[model samples]
Target: MTPISSKGRTRGGLAALICGALAAGGLAAAGTTALTPQAAHASSHREAPLISGTPQYDNTDLYAFVSPDRPDTTTIVADWIPFEEPAGGPNFYPFAEDAQYDLHIDNNGDAHGELLFRYTFKTHVRNKHTFLYNTGPVDSLDDPDLNVTQTYDIELIRLKNQHVMSKTKIADDVPVAPSNVGKASMPDYGKLRDQAVHQLPNGAVTFAGQADDPFFLDLRVFDLLYGGNLSEVGNDTLKGYNVNSIALQVPTHLLTESAHQPVVGIWSTTQRRTAHGSYAQVSRLGNPLVNEVVNPQKDKDTFNASSPWQDARFLKNVTNPELPRLIESIYKIKAPAEPRNDLVDVFLKGVPGLNQPPHVTPAEELRLNTSVKPSMHPKRLGVLDGDTAGFPNGRRLTDDVVDAALQVVEGELVGSKNDLGDAVDANDKEFGHTFPYLAEPTEGSRGPLAKGTSGGTDVRSQLGDALQPAGESRNTTLIAASAASGAAGVLLIGTGLAWWRRRVRRPY
Candidate 1:
């Protein structure tokens, strides 16, 4: 045989070492390998480069679970990045028909076998009218038939053994729905709304349509830190004030593999038409939005490519395994030595933190352990009270994920007795009490404005000032200011009490 190249020999040796370690450490018997420090840091978010601009395909978040609000059923919430403009009207956002959206679950730690739930949409244009309708001067309006009818059907596919074996239509021949507040007849928007609020056979309810985008992140602040390098540190600017959203609610029985203890993972996918008329698609195939990870500048066009599917294949290659190391290297900070392998156990294993894990996953996919009983009318601020249904489970539109994330970063969730040290809450934004649960916009309403006018003034400056951190003093002027800011304080107080007490005590 020809002599093996030095590089090939090295690779072979490394593979043997890995296998030997797994077997010797007894991990092979457990069907799991302890993620090496490097491998633990390799976990990435947002794979497709083009997804940066296309929030519809961004797959910003994946949530799987037995619903806390409705324990008998399971709910899968997939949040896409780059929030859409709610008023990006004319063509409201809808899931791509050809695209395959999936929710995956790896019950074993090997991260190989996954129970996949896929979704596909088929558009149905009821009326071939170009324009939706004309509002002000019907006579003067260029397009009188501005109101058009559109509908789409939704299909769910279950993937096993790398092939789709079963398919179910969540919505059978449903109309393209519109916002609920609009007139019912002119567009008969109610029909669409009604179609969305249908009841499934298992007494489980499913709603899929355009709802108020619930994700609220201070994108402007992030941009300021990395892009503009602004000095306004205590500012809170919600750049994604409005966006298109797709919401779904399913019974828990449907998700669980045998009503025993339900556990699952979820993620979304998007596809687009290639220049060749054929389509290109992306799946769990690659790391999402590499621009956010590697090269922010050169990755823009890469993120905008029409063929995201092609990009998925090379995802694992581009991913830097020592991502946390890279960050620490760049920042010139020491990497924390608090057991990185245990992170999956703490973060993804439903360990209480500033927020609960969205779901339980064998390897960090959005995991929801159905064995955990659902909380009836559970408090939304989960980690504060030790409820596992909140943030880490499936993040709700109203979840204070920023605050939750901050707490985790500060080591607040792991307990004061732990060597990692205790952390305190920094940001404060509670959620509303409904589906698509985001705090109601500070702006009053959405309607026709004066000739030369604008809608809601930026509430960030005001709200940010009122909510800024007060340093070591637990009761600072900022807290008082927030307390005085209308009913916000009451909600905060209630949620805070629940969080403080629940966090202090462990609940099974």
Candidate 2:
């Protein structure tokens, strides 16, 4: 077991205090600005054209933070399969068996991974003929009634300048928590989730399964940037949806280069098996909104498949971001002057003196100083709010990255610090405080379901009978007809909405 010690606060605290001082003054001034760009923000969710069609392989978000409860370790959580509907039955979400989900670590400043954790999944079905996801209540991971189950293997690979130096299968046959298939099927999803949290022989903790999508932001930004007048602000579009997550908590010593070098850069990637039976990297995510806000349409998919070492190609995108120009066009705000080195420091390279590595390569990564202790009371605005323990240092679930990124993109670091946001401040569900700290997945039975549906209630009705028979009272028949018409109208609206969503490139 690693020794418990509070480390790096002297440097981290002083740096945070200085950032805090600047944020305090700038935030207060920014408060009075009339232009709040709520529509100009979103995280990585179906951000690219190709990934939108393949939710199973799309890497939605990646979070890395020093364990708040157990500071001796760092926990990294990578989520996939964005926007899972709770009631989607028959076949709920599962980690793709033909894909490789990876978490990459760059301990030195070489812009390439020195360590890589690869996860591969395999699904099992108890009954081949059965269409049901579960035959009966799944009280445990090994329940015989659970027809469809998933297990995964994790491999730890040591790399030297992207060359594999060693490969070891750290854990295998670990149960993945099943989807929350309503109360009737999974009576205690929480218990099942706990059971999936396996403690490995190497003092690492691993969990893989469905959890509430922790990234929060007004995705309505795509709706004409919040209806152009900010009418679509303040609502968390991702509320109630779920995502398949793979989490790992390892000893702090394992991630650092040495005691003298405490900084580490992390990112996640997904490689899908191609038709030739070879895997091709399809999706990559590190810092939030990089592909969505920083990269343009032509290069969106390109960035996803690229390695950090080759990030110099995308450097111009950061220095001259389209987000600020778009903001300038819609609102009257002046875009930050070009060759924006401020953004280069904050996004491409980690902020100097805070999370930046010594002699670092300019590349994208969720850089974290593992020695920085978790904040007792973490601020949502993250480093901008002076809470260096949060985002940009490495994202905690509670960090309000949408607001933080908006302000930073709008020149918060270059002295123009104002709170420009999507108006959605926090996650709709509260996150847990344990090893796998995401909120419980929203159950299919977690109600306000269809109008008359209730637990075990029969919803079957005679087709068109509710419209009233010809012999019924004239007034009653007329009223029934009116009700049926209203129902039909609602159905049409819903159908049209679905079609419209499909038409958009980044619907989720």
Candidate 3:
């Protein structure tokens, strides 16, 4: 994306430049936390030391947007359990039974959630006598063969200034989409996903299940900030990985203060059950990279636990960001002057006349103005590309947030205009067009290249090559082959988790 040139307007003072910059297209950048060895990995994926160890309770990315197909509704997607290897099984990933996943809406710009959607999951195991996850080929969510399953309950809670005024169970016993085990087991995975989607009594649609990790970016920046020469770029780090996702689509009027006030702030949090049986908020995500790149080590965990209204302590991170300064030191590009109030406004509050609500509380949130209709031809760079319908208006599945945020972090807003990007522009997989828009989770059958079948081999052929020995009878070898595959998958999981922990522990 090219920079917005100064053709009609003169480069006046910083204030004028800020106003002009915000008016044309708002800044999508926000203050970031300490860069870990896993820096630039999927936004908010394993961002903190404590949360990194608890993937199921970790908040990966949050997306909120006016539904492109049905403009009358807004879709909010929050992902957890980052980097889920499709093959990691026996006991595949499941929503933490003891945790409470919540989606919060600040409709009045008060930085406090006026409404919250709390999701609690329960696991079901029909055949404890067998080691199999499924007894036979599964065709539907309620298929008898599916021995292990999960169901969740959704509670709609109304609060005034954080104190709950009302709580109602909107959905109960909603089936969660099971993991896409290989084709033989879950022959029609798509059908299972469709069955998992549930319609709530409040005219809302909800889905909870495994989906492809939609966040894409060049995560190799951890290697001395792109090999310290921009050499390590363009690779989508999150490709092939899956995440457990919770998607909700609610009527537009329900999220806003009123028809007149369409702007609303959105965020998600994961609360784990403590030893005392009290649920404690362990993970929170709003904007894509706020906790990943803005907060320091000392404050990363604190940021996760704190509420939006109590964000005053982290204000310095926004006003005087470290990312630009690091870029300046490494690349010799001059950093923007200190005290970046423009960042504070756009990221914490929202862009005025765009998505910013009147009487904003200046807290970090994915603020969306439902009044702005969906774009027919969405620009990946989002608002920076003059497509106000995308982020930072509210993040869309297709928004190139890494590029837009990079450009802004390099001082695009304060007149140092240029394009800076991670080069990885879009998600490796195409997102769905329906209610739960995330792409289907990668199936467990995927395997690495073998000696002869290396080029463009289809998955079925690969599976056959992996399972059937030369001239071996199908029935005789299938059981042994499947056992071997399961063992390999378990080994893969162990190695992957160890590698990830090492990376997470590395100092920035």
Number of the predicted model whose TM-score against the real structure is largest? 3
lDDT of 3 by residue, 170-243 (tens): 99999999988877899899999999889887679999999999999888876766777777788998999999
Candidate 2 segments whose C-alpha is farther than 4 A from its true place: 1-43, 449-508
Question: Global lDDT for candidate 2?
Answer: 0.79
Q: Which residue runs of candidate 3 sit more than 4 Å off their true CA positions?
A: 1-42, 449-508
Candidate 1 overall Cα lDDT vs. reference?
Answer: 0.40
lDDT of 2 by residue, 443-479 (tens): 9877644435543332322123245467866344433
Q: What are the clashing pairs of model 2?
A: none
**What are the per-residue Cα lDDT tens digits for candidate 1 across 225-323?**
223332323333433243334456666556555544445444444555667877554433111222333234444334333222123322232222233
Alpha-carbon runs more than 4 Å astray in model 1: 1-48, 53-56, 105-117, 124-130, 133-146, 179-195, 224-240, 272-280, 283-335, 346-362, 374-381, 410-508
TM-score of each: 0.57, 0.82, 0.84
Candidate lDDT values, in order: 0.40, 0.79, 0.81
Give the range of the ten consecutive residues with the poorest summed lDDT in model 1. 1-10
